[model samples]
Target chain A: MDFKKITIFAGHYGSGKTNLAVNLAFHHKAQGRDCTICDLDIVNPYFRSKDSEEDFKAAGIRFISSPFANSNVDLPSIPAEAYSVFAKSDTYSVIDLGGDDRGSYALGRFSEFLTDESTYDMLMVINQYRPDTRTPEQVLEIKKEIEDACHVKFTGIVNNSNLGRETTVELIERTREFADECAKLLNLPLVMTTYSDKLEKPNMPNPFAINIMAKDIWQV
Target chain B: MAEKVLMKGNEALAEAAMRAGCRFFFGYPITPQTEVAAYMAKHMRKNGGTYLQAESEIAAINMVLGAASAGQRVLTSSSSPGISLKSEGISYLAGSDLPAVIINIQRGGPGLGGIQPSQSDYFQATRGLGHGDFHVIVVAPSTVQEMVNLTYDAFDMADLYRMPVMILGDGILGQMMEPAEFPTESSRKLPAKDWATTGTKGERKKNIVNSLYLDPAELERTNFERYERYEKIKATEQKAECFMTEDADIVVVAYGAAARVAKNAVLAARDAGIKVGIVRPITLWPYPSDTLKEVAKTAKAFLSVELSMGQMVEDIKLSIDCAKPVYLCNRTGGMVMKPDEVLAKIKEISGGLK
Candidate 1:
């Protein structure tokens, strides 16, 4: 059995953090592992785990949210339930943080939740199409902004660049290379890559595990 | 029968679609709505289903269109800006008389608006998302539980009417985690799809699914046919949940997340010795006009509470014939009206009655 570990995903706006978190949870769940996802996003008002709670429930995956997580315009505050999840030594947890620098601020509150060398993998998801994060250098700058705000080191990266339904293998490869280079430069592992199921298997040699989206992962 | 588990609105929508026999989903990541796509992606594959993270909202909707054309239960979701991009596809889906599900967990918007929840898309959603004459079935789910239940109804109505069904949600409803009992595993059944394009074979004629009709006369005929279907849908699918309105003197009109806020307001008013009730329209497109008209007859005044400045208020007035004073209580650009704010409006309007 794969031992339960905490995976934290962070990224810029439209960086596909939720996508990675949901996919990772599903991947673990498919392996007969118990997984819980806590949506800690109080920023980037849309595309968080809270939106698809029903689906998670049906899949026997537990979902946690903060108390102030509402649809109204207020920024979300991390709830006690989130801290409780992190406090636990057992059970695999994935925290899908919000997008943008605000996400970094949100991550700062969970500092106490991290334990020393606790096998927590902090992944920075990069989508090259979004502005302020198109190039590896831009991603590094965004990463620096997040690292500075959260005071946490990013351990790895995930490349999730795609041009919607028209995304081609070339585009995926280009993104993969960019992320790989960033990972190499940062001396971190290139954790995984994601592709819309619309793409046929690419010819490039796989250097990392691939996340093939079967559907909206959060929908259950 | 299946066991019931507590669920949130986003998750409930996924479960409801599954119950409706939905097997295909495509969507881009957006807040207050990412859960819908995430939920679908997680389980669809296990059930021998298809889930795709399309490149954009446009691709996702078109993917839904393609899958729906194949006679599969398919859905796509997004928030405000994403939904705006989907308008063209939505119009096309409506024009083609295709059955699919689209969800909009609304946020403030004209362009790249803040992510905070807002209901500013009322006019955009109900007034027709895209060009030409067409209407999609729009269901407003105020709670996480209703999000699930109504999503089931959305697929049913969509297929029944051969139109796209939309779950018009706000950021609050999409983001909040609440307890809800979900249907048991065994009780969920995939609906029959005789109209899908899963390869034309021995007994069935070739099925052509396209929105383009170059012949004006032919297009007109299709439009009339769709209108006829919409008429039937409007007559049958007008749904609203009335709370404490039976003997109340004041009726508050609201829907989606605003309805929940309004519910609290009504409860607070009742506590303060005010006889106020709420009429939450679950089906925004149908507008629940018949019920609102009935409630308007007895209520001294009707207050429309919403997150948008006053978009849905116009709908309320038009639906109820503005017989009584139709007052507006609203917040804009991702701001939500507090319960006290709504009660103050109710009190102010009630004072006028004296």
Candidate 2:
């Protein structure tokens, strides 16, 4: 349940960052924190953070969706409320950036606001199931792209590896070494590894059990 | 036998091409098909092969043409819209009688459709991808392992026949994970590329690689020659799988991902005491039309299950050209039909048959 006052999520497409962002936003709001979820996803038109906008608002969390999100138009418009997340020191802001270099360019425009990288936590989500981000070197290559575009360093890693609802507990358990290798390569803490299973395993380190409602429906 | 590795269909296809000694690849990135290009880019550089991302799909296939003209094993991969963009090059390749491989990891489309898995390109593949009376050797694969073996064979098939070969897969196959063990051995003996425009060094007549036959008589003759080859190909290179066809009433005709889904429905319907089977076409160009006719003789009806609205069903009906009724069970634009839904359709058809 530990998180920074402001945490930014970014990764390759299908890395499960949106699911994690939504999960964390709900977690903080449930704990009675002033949580705000920013959906800055313009990389993919579908399966984005804004799909949970009504859910986030219903749970007493402020939601900032992309200007033209969920529409046919792909205009790159960053909402003003995205910048205000930085000003509110008492609020727990969750920024769900889009996948890959195409989605991260919008993050660069907010470079001036991210001058203090120490206060804000940037979590690079990795899902090795995706071919492009399958290896630690490939993960580093993608990580570098996001870092260069966002003009901020990633403080930690989140191993949110799964193949939708078909993902099993053993698959999440098996990915720990791969995630550890990637964390070692980046010299960052493996802040959390997510699983959708209801039961928690004993040997899991920094495990975050979550319920993924948005992703499974789309897989169907 | 090579060790088994779980690979996505797109990645495995590219790897299979690499093993088949395909040294040149040109592509433009489009999903659910970009992994093929990405894999080529990552490996081709290290392996001392040529991998170039062209400015567009049109340019990519033209690059394949240039490489094939030089008698090098070449390839290009794309999705539906990107493949549509490469139509000109595809026609040119067919007309020139060049040997190359094109993999279409299909997505939903008539235009710029959604980027989800679909088998909507059945008509484009079987009825010729572009203009002119031509056909590519279209091979539809249903599994990741087949993605490897079929792609490897597609190169040799393209060379043996001096024609382009299309490996038709869908988004689910492209993105799904499954265990695949590429065969270390293949018995396909490829023909020589004597017609290649590689330099003759003044030892023989200079070979020309041209698609344009401006003279009407000569063009007609060329078309006649191509059709002869097509007829021979039709006679020889047809592959299909008939699952539980014996003593079955209803047969489901599908290919690629839809076939796998339909197989489940077929089995489920059988448990419910319906005599249902499935006919999966592995080769789409020289489609398994005869198989449908053979099944049509005994079965009550045939259901054409697809990810598109009644594209391949036309081929099914034409294949039989009979009085037996043919039905369609389809979903378009990236939606996957559930097995239970397919079972319901089968039940409805069974009622009609009764």
Candidate 3:
């Protein structure tokens, strides 16, 4: 639960950031803090943070996303209420950014406010199993791309390597070094390692348990 | 065996095509399927292939035609509306007997309908993708892993039959993540493209790739020959997966994302003591009529579940020759049918069964 006032999750497409963002918001809510989560994904058409709107409302956490979210219409427009994350100082805001540099362009709207490094932590969620960012070099390239798009440097890294529903603790353990190599290459602090709540918690540093929320109803 | 990796369906299909020896990819970005083009743009060049984001879907399909005419494996993908724009080119590809692969990650549609998952393109894909007496081999895959496997197979099939092969999917199948192991290499030994428009170098006759046969008798002869190839393909390549169809009184027919939901519903129905099973068609063009005919002999009734307004129901009726009543369970315009709804329909159909 130790984090900045504003935490941003950004990474390659399908890197499990939306799930992590939801879990982090709930974690802060459990600690009796006023938490708000924002969904800034315009790149992906499905399986986004907006899908967890009902869950956030049930947990008494404010959720901000596109008005056309979860609808047949797919617009890249973000809501005006998203700026409240920057304006509100007392509330804890966890922003679930869209994947890749193109997706990061939405974050650029609030770039002026994100300049205060003490208040915001942009964490690049790296999944080694993703086709686009499998190597440390690939991870660094994405980090730079995201930074250039949003004009905000990534403050830390989160190793969220997994093979969708097939993720195992043993798989996570084997992929730890890839995350470590990526963090070392980027010279960013390895913030946390995430594992699905479906699995037993593994013995790893900064373990964050997440529920895969963004999925089709029929997905097992 | 390669390690299983988490891949979005669009990316997986693009990778599968690349590994299947597809070196030319011309595409236009559309919702629910842009990842296929984006992935190709990022990796196709590094894999020693060409990835061009053409100005429009029409241009993209024509680019596919050019590459395919050269005897190179080519790919072009888009959503429902984009596929409509590519229809003219698709017809040309079929008319010229060019082998190419097309991916249609369907969205709700008549015209610019919506971006959510839909199987409404069933008729458009299987019956009439373009205006011609030709049929494209349409493969409908429900899972991301199947998306990969089918895409790889599609290229081989397109080459073997000298026709376009389409992987007809919906938004859900295009956007969802799943663990899939891509084939490192093609499983079949592909035949050489002797008919390709490669330079003759004055050694032989120059090959002409054209569909315009002005002579009426010649055109009729060509059409007959094409239908003969189609008949041969129909006999050899009809695929369907029957889940618990043995001795079931009620059989549900579905394909693509709808089949996934129907399977879950069939499992739920079985738990409630209602004898229900599912017939999932992998090849939509050939229609998998033989399997349906075989299941129809034992099954008392049929249910066609779809994400459209009863398009596949007609196919189910024709496949079974209407020996038994085939009911339709459907939702349209971006709304997918729920398993509970399908289960209720199945239970109702089971109760009415004589």
Candidate 4:
């Protein structure tokens, strides 16, 4: 309940940032706090946080994303209402950023607001199982690319590593050292290690359990 | 050996192609399938390959033609409209007898349809990928893991047949994430590129790769030769997955994303005491007629489930020579049919059979 005013989730593609963003928004809403989740995903054509717009609406949380989000039109046009995330100080803002540096370019437009350390927490969500970010050095390389593109530094690291559906508690425990190594190498605090709500919670520090929101088409 | 990892279908196909020794990728980005080009751009060079984002889909496919003619395992990918643009180059590749793998991560439409999953390009891919009396080996993958395996195999099939091979996927397959393992070693002994127009080093005569035949007699002769090769492929390369079809009275036929949905429906229908089975064709061009012909011996009726207005239904009818009634269960314009909808169709067909 003590998150920063604006929490931005950025990571590699399919690293579970969209799911974390949705969970964070629900987390804020459940605690009797107003929240707005803005989708800054231009790089990925499918699977964005905006896909849960109806769920967000039913929960009374504000959603801002491309008009083309969840539509037949595949455009990268971010809505003008996304600017309200910074202007409204009363509502907690969660930004679900697209994957990699190209995805982070949309974040560059809001660099002026994100510069203040106290107001925003820019977390680099990393999954060690992903092909591109399998190690601390690889994660760091992405961190630098994202930092360069968005012109904002990642304040902390979030370990959200797991194989989809085949994830086990043992696998989570095995990845603890990898997450710690990433934090150490990046010189950032380990903000949290997320696990799917469907699985039993593993014995890990900063355990943030999240509901899976960005689902495969077959799951429907 | 690379560890099994969770990958989006598009990325998995791109990664598999690289592992299959595909060193050149020429593509222009489009919806759903953009990740394939993006992945190639990010990692292809690291794997000792060339990834070029061409100015247009036409240019990209032509580039594939050029590289493939030089005996390099090359690839190009696009969505529905972009694939249409590349059709001319694809025909040229076939005409020139070059080997290349073309990926169509299908979206809806005749014009600029929708940016969602679709199988409407079934006719375009199987029957008329280009204006040619030739054929491209069209392989449709239902899962991301299959996307990996089929993509790795597509390159080999292209080379083995000395023609183009297609990996026909839909937006759902392109975007979904699944755990996939990459093959470390190829199963086939690839034929040497003696037919490649690599060059003359003064030791041998120069080889030429061309599609133009001015004389009508010469063109007809070449067409006959190509059809003979096509016949060989038809005999050997027809692949399908028959699920619970041994004693079923109603067999459902589908491919790609629609097949995945139809399989789920078939399972549900069987549980509900409706005798139903699914026949999923892995290769659309080869059509897997023999498998359907076999199933038709016992099946009272067949349902051709699709994401189009029944394009594959014609093939299903022809596959079995219309011995039994063939029904179409489909959704078009980016709308995918639900499992329940397909189950209802199976029930209707079963009721009529009774």
Correct interface contacts retained, every candidate: 0.09, 0.00, 0.69, 0.53
Worst 10 residues of 4 chain B by lDDT: B182-191
**Candidate 4 local lDDT, B1-354, one digit each (tens):** 567788999999999999999999999989989999999999999998899999999999999989998999999999999999999999999999999999999998989998988999999999999996989999999988899999888998999989999999999999999888898977877889998888888878888999999998999999999999999999999999999999999999999988888888998998999888989999998999999999999999999999999899899999989899999999999888888899889998888887
TM-score of each predicted structure versus truth: 0.65, 0.84, 0.98, 0.97
> Could you give the candidate ranking by TM-score, starting with the highest?
3, 4, 2, 1
Q: Is candidate 2 or candidate 4 better by TM-score?
A: 4
Residue A13, model 4, lDDT? 80
lDDT of each: 0.77, 0.84, 0.90, 0.90
lDDT tens digits by residue: candidate 3, A1-220: 3788999999998898888999899999998999999999888788877777788899999999898887877778899999899995798999998999998999998999988888989999988888778899999999999999999999999999998878899999887788788878999988898888899887666888887776667633
**Interface residue Cα RMSD of candidate 2 after superposition:** 5.8
lDDT (tens digit, per residue) of candidate 4 on A118-142: 8999999988778888889999999
For B204-306, candidate 1 gives per-residue lDDT tens digits of: 8977888898899999998888788778877887999999998788899999878877888889889988999999998889889999889888888888888
How many collisions between residues are there in candidate 1?
48
RMSD of each: 15.9, 3.9, 1.2, 1.4
Instruction: List residue ranges in candidate 2 displaced over 4 A.
Output: A12-14, A22-37, A45-93, A115-119, A127-138, A160-178, A196-202, A210-220, B1-16, B29-43, B107-118, B143-146, B171-187, B214-222, B260-273, B333-341
Q: After superposition, how far is residue B79 of candidate 1 from its true place, in Å?
A: 0.4
What C-alpha lDDT, on a 0 to 100 scale, does residue B91 get in candidate 2? 95
lDDT of 2 at A32: 85
List residue ranges in candidate 4 displaced over 4 A: none
lDDT of 2 by residue, A138-206 (tens): 999888888888787888999887755456777678787899999999898898888875656525578
Candidate 3 chain A, poorest ten consecutive residues by summed lDDT? A211-220
